[model samples]
Target: AEVCYVGVTSSAPSSVARTPEQFTQKLDAFAQKRADVHGQPVSTHTIVSPDPIADLDDDLIKAIKEVGADLVVMPTHPPKNLDVIMPSHGGKVATHTNVSVFLVRPRDG
Candidate 1:
């Protein structure tokens, strides 16, 4: 299967001091490394928006549609409060997108 990594970044000025080009280069390097390890070609796309974090699912859905992806695999973290019904970014994406979504939770310490 082919691999495409999409990275979203902020368009608004930030204190992080990293240029969009630098961020894109970092994403490319990381994607290349993963591609090398997986022994497959990996393409990368970087999206610069005013508030990618707030619209995470939107960006993800857009990228998936643009790439014509049938499935999406993304990392997700557990909610801080179990009582809250707030959906995670992955959950929001899954609900909004037409493709299958695979959410992987990271191992806790």
Candidate 2:
């Protein structure tokens, strides 16, 4: 089974969680919402970053490496001009990491 780490980042000086139970409760709520939307059980390992708000691409790559993820799925907005579309953080991650990335661009409504 693949381990999913739900990362939570905070920039505050106090990095330690106030209460482990409270932290777990919030994470559990998020997991439940995800499961409800997907209509399937979701297993997640939670992570609270000590040093927060680093480069998003670097953070994602670091997280991927930590979990040894074989694949990554990221969502992007549909671009009007495919040729001129700017590279997103997801794109950077794919470029830098050996792991495969599957980018999903939802159809523009």
Candidate 1 lDDT over residue span 35-100, tens digit each? 889899888888887787777778888899899888899998866785267778888788888989
Q: Write the per-residue lDDT of candidate 2 for residues 1-109, one digit (tens) a residue.
A: 3436455444343344465445656677877787777777655544455554555667788778877788887777665465367567677888999999888998857
Q: What is the lDDT of residue 27 in candidate 2?
A: 72
Model 2 ranges off by over 4 Å: 3-5, 12-25, 32-54, 80-86
RMSD of 1: 2.1
- What are the TM-scores, per candidate, against the unseen true structure? 0.86, 0.60
Which lDDT value does model 2 have at 57?
66
Which ten contiguous residues of candidate 2 have the minimum total lDDT? 8-17
